[model samples]
Target: MMAIFQPFFNIISETGRVVQFFFQMLDVWKRKSISRDLMFEQIWKVTVQSSATTALAGFFVGAIMTVQFTMEMKDFGALGYLGGLSTSGTIREVGPLLIAFMLAGKVGAFTSAELGTMRVTEQIDAIRCLGADPIQELVLPRFIAIVISSFFLLGLGLLLSIFGGMLLGKYFSGVNYEEYLRHIPTIVSLPSILSGLFKCFVFAVVLAVICTHRGYSTTGGAKGVGRSVVQTAVSTMVAIVIADWATSLLADIALKIFLRSR
Candidate 1:
């Protein structure tokens, strides 16, 4: 009884904390309490660290979706539509969600672990004792970097998914490039593209906040760092899935509205 409600209360408390932290970050940014060098360096580090995994995940996601569609469309003698359908589905939904999951495991875990380590080592405290704001110097840069890097990487993954589907279609499904790409412009609309990008941005923010919050709040030394990493992964993945579902619902509604207006 209490155990069940306890988790709910914990979730609510944690969410409030995350929101407060985000507002603190925004306030810091408004004050220009940011380190340009730290921010750029962190961005470059996260981007480089996550790019390879993102590419591999994105490409394989597109390829796998193509294969599934190929298997289905083949039964109906509809292989020619493989590219457009696969690419459309990947770009509009599968690509962003899967790629974000990958990012959560890779980028989210790493960031949380790194920050947790720093906290456990008293490095954050050392900075604070020196009359420096740790959030501005440490967390802010990471928060901004993760968001930017994630958004860029997610977009890149979506783009690569197109080529991946195209290649798989050619080699595996015997669908030529021309036929595979033919219906994309018609099937994949402006709203679909916008929805995917919007999801990416939302995912980026969620990942950054969850990771940083878990790490920044870590205690109890090394063990706590491990716990923080695990919690961060779970929280980020859950957040990403919820965001995906919400965005998908909103996208559908907006698409209907746009079509009706047209």
Candidate 2:
């Protein structure tokens, strides 16, 4: 009985810790204790590191989606709609989710390891001993940077995915660029675009919080840092998937309500 309940207790305890840490960061932000230079440096570093990879992943996602849609539509003589259908699917669901996963694996893991190292090496403790708040001097900048960079990178990926789908549609299905892009406006609405961006924002926050929390709590030295990285990856991925489902459901409901009102 105790063993079965242990996992549930662990989940609750972890959730509490994450929430507490998030509020601490929030309090720092509220007090304007964040260092602009540190925040900007982190933002630039992460953005530069992840840009190419994120763009490549986004482009391929669109291309693969186009290919799948093309195959399905070709059987029905509907290849002309490939661009719109694929673009709609990618932008609304696949693009943000998969791009976010890529960001988690790269950005999340690196941040966790870096923080974990500092924690185990007693750098964080040294800062505290010297009368500096590590949260303000360290974690806060990273937290803000990850949120900003992740948002921009995810959006960039979504943009590239459109071009990707168009290029692939033109070559693979013999669909002209104009025809391929023609139905996008008809299929992908403003609300859908907003929903995707919202999901990106939510995923970014989730990724930032998990990585920082895991890193800050790391205890066992090198092995502990490794464990934290693994935990960050697994937890962030699971959280993102849950967030994606919840956002999709809410977006659909909101759209329905809006349509009824109009």
Candidate 3:
């Protein structure tokens, strides 16, 4: 039915727009389509304002995983192994995932709603009429900000997660001091860090495309803007999960190739 296919076509059309926007950004990367001031301001907003939430989410995720699993591991008399396992698990999976969810709920929704409101207000069109590429003026800076922010946030989350696992191993898990310390900072590896950052970058791109596309598709008015926010959150999360698994496989392959090359 047309109704079933309508969403599919819209998604495809949006995909095209995202590609076009990406290419346009690439073309203008040197000239810097947008002003430095605007880009930095947006970057600051994404990175700094989001830090508290990121820290809390990352810490709690690590703590909860450690608490939940430490008990299970203890039943098997394997408590000694929990610290490293928990910390590594957090870095390899939890950090990027929670960060993606947080970004979807907070930043992605905000970007969609903001852009949708602008579209409703004809601001985007006005910018176009004034001889500015909306993609460059609006989308490029956001794309740059989010990708950079996600990478930094991924690292931050990893650190906080390790820190949280440390606290739990010491206080909640009944693990010994040397064991706890050794558990955490020990599993740090280049591949895990690189994979996490790479996934974060892909998520950043997914969020940007979903939010901006939904914003541009806004039609009805205030109602449309609200719809876009919801759509952006849902779409971004779905895209992130898919990308997460896919990138993990790609990372494995790439790591293998790198190892062979070396």
Query: What is the full ranking by lDDT, best candidate first?
Result: 2, 1, 3
Q: Candidate 2, residues 17-56: lDDT per residue as tens digits? A: 9999999889877886677899999999989889999899
- TM-score of candidate 2 versus the correct structure, residues matched by position: 0.95
The TM-score that candidate 1 achieves is 0.94
Residues 78-119, candidate 3: write the lDDT tens digits: 787777777667766778778888888888888888889999
User: How much lDDT does each candidate structure score?
Assistant: 0.86, 0.88, 0.80
- Residues 1-262, candidate 1: write the lDDT tens digits: 8997998999999999999988987888888668789999999998898888888888888899889999999989989888778877877888678767877898789889988999999998999999998888888899888878877887778778878888999999999989988988878889988887888788888888889888988999999999999999999999999999899999899999999999
- The model with the greatest TM-score is 2
In model 3, residue pairs whose N, Cα or C atoms come closer than 3 Å (at least 3 residues apart or on different chains), thus clashing, are: none
**Each candidate: RMSD to true structure?**
1.6, 1.4, 2.5
* TM-score, prediction 3: 0.87
Clashes of each: 0, 0, 0
Candidate 2 has which clashing residue pairs, if any?
A: none
Report the CA-based lDDT of candidate 3 relative to the real structure.
0.80
Error of 3 at 72 (Å): 4.3
